[model samples]
Target: MADHCNGSSHSSESFANIPPIKFTKLFINGNFVDSVSGKTFEAIDPRTGEAITLVSKGDKEDVDLAVKAARFAFDNGPWPRLSGSERGRILMKLADLIEENIEEIASLDAINGGKLFSLCKLIDIPAASMALRYYAGAADKIHGTVLKLSKGLQGYTLREPIGVVGAIIPWNFPTIMFFMKVAPALAAGCTIVVKPAEQTPLSALYYAHLAKLAGVPDGVLNVVNGYGETAGAAISSHMDIDKVSFTGSTEVGRKIMVAAATSNLKPVSLELGGKSPLLIFDDADVDEAANIAFNGMFFNKGEICVASSRVYVQEGIYDKIVDKLVEKAKALVVGDPFDPQVNQGPQTDKKQFEKILSYIEHGKREGATLLTGGKHIGQKGYYIQPTIFADVKNYGRGD
Candidate 1:
């Protein structure tokens, strides 16, 4: 099927302008190309729960190609060989291009990942651009240090780019995470192969296109999209890959660690799960603490790793705080992401929706009080109400 857009003309003045998604293939060596298997998966619109576009499905063969391309670029391409100042210039250009196409990028992210347009436009895009600029500014500043030698000879230590980074980013914050992993690697003159979560691949592929437009060289950045078991495993286990940076579940992080060790003992950085806690004292400002606690857990529909899932309060203020939180959650609109008034949008996909629902069910079965919203909102889309379980023990477990 042909790519569809909202039919608005691409112009600077149009706040709702979004260019049609032109390419859904694997981006390798700075080019959008098809997978070796010739298979594609549907990219869905979470709002409508419908198929939007067909994206190339990459597996081991595609990962191999992407890794080899990245290795070649890191070892011999002009990107690594160029002066740090020159590299910074390219990154700066890319940042400018991202700013120019912020509307399009924001749209793609919302449609592909179920992120709110208002939030992506006002939050994610700006943060991603700033991240690129931050790394660009730091690019030329990395310097080697002269060290004291034990003997008559002089010695110096150099900080070099760890080659061929295998970056696996989650679906919750695709665009921001992409920049977080890619920008620093680019600044340090490292090449990379990115495996964006299958649920949210469009933004990363679109970013790759912008990178090419901004004069990032061929093979410097490659993006492959597929299931975690196949494409993710391939990238993690590739002998040519020197490092792996993963942002996902703790279970999957452990798997990636095992894969990294079994493959070539490559270095791995895992930013895994956190059941973060929030403590509220009797002396603290109730309004301020309630607001902070509300935002912490419900900001991303409670999908964030550091979301304050567990809240501990002094017995005196617990009832008051819970009442205020319930009122706040009730006021929040749960509807279309394009609507600025809506504070909570649909969950990213079915799996996450079910997972959250399961937790709510477990809370109920365990006799924890259901304070507010423990059910689905509407028939269509993956929408879930803002759920809260009070009168719960901190160390409670769920099936």
Candidate 2:
């Protein structure tokens, strides 16, 4: 393995201004290496609407390489061979490294994923650190009980590692999702091959750098940034991968399930899309309900899969609640993500921005009343106004 210490360097000043990065590579086996096919993709900054970096356009070849690395680590490397307590120590070290570089990681996430800086620092970063710690604390605690048999034969169970795991995360919450999937898998002694969303790949790549810094062994954890059709399919279908965990759209989840069955019959855990509804009862406080409803839909510009995009307000206070929600949506600040006062940032990419706009148009054409905004904010960036549709039949299907 290459010297992991020479991977990437970040200084205090690098965090001050968003540095120009050429992210045209994949991270595997503790090194940032170019794609086998030598292809690249543009990573745009949603806040500025400019291409900030060029990331590796990974395909089947790249995914195969990463999965092989993870398989090697799981089968023969020191990682799977380490004692549970020793693995826990390394995980704790990773959590500490994340805490130490929270600023840089959060900044990269904001620039790449269009997340608010305040949200990244206050919510995502700290939450990621806490998750790592939680899994670290649980690493050595994973125990199986001994079973007593009726006959003379003695029996027991061993909670062994699940071998190699493939984790595919969405773009909305990159940093937090990375740790959410990675920490638990590591704690369970599973080597991982991660494919972050193509739009928000930088934060995951940067986290891989931190993993090396924290002394994670080569081939233990690998990240390959690419489109879902190629790299994602490779990871999902690889014969050597024992399990697959995916968090993304329901459409993509279906594809992953098919791939898993056809290729290796691997175990799959899918956290798929949902149009969650927030039902407000007549007895609920009007003001609190309005506040929660507004936040649930608009918090991540409604990009999150579990975002409460469908809200059911009881008929008793429907009009009053609509009025309050309209007022709140209008009050939201939409602009640069770096600005602390801005309440909402742009969507993570152009495709999502256009999708949100199309949904607004569908709502309008379907005769749902546009109570507030339903347009773009500025000439640049992928910003969309916080939109509200009232008079939507409580029973009507949300477009």
Model 2: lDDT to the true structure? 0.84
Q: Per-residue CA lDDT of candidate 1, range 1-399, in tens?
A: 101111111111212455789879999988899999999999987766778899999999999999989989988899888888999999999999998988788888877777888889899999999999999999999999998788887889898898999999999999999999999999999999999999999999989999999999999999999999999999889999999999999999999999999989999999998899999999989999999999998997787999998889999999999999988876766766665656766688888988999999999998899988887765566777777889895565772
Once fitted onto the true fold, the runs of candidate 1 whose alpha carbons sit more than 4 angstroms away are 1-18, 396-399
TM-scores, one per candidate: 0.94, 0.93
lDDT of 2 at 275: 88
lDDT of 2 by residue, 1-399 (tens): 111111121111112466555344799998999999888988988876788878888888888888889998888898878888888898899889888887778788888888888789899999999999999899889988888887887788889999999999999989888988999999888999999999999989878888888888999999999999888999999999999999999999999999999988999999988889999989999999998998898887677877898988888998888999888887777766666666777799999999889989988887999878888765667777778898785455573
C-alpha lDDT of residue 259 in model 2:
96
Model 2 clash number: 0
* TM-score for candidate 1: 0.94
- Candidate 2, poorest ten consecutive residues by summed lDDT: 1-10
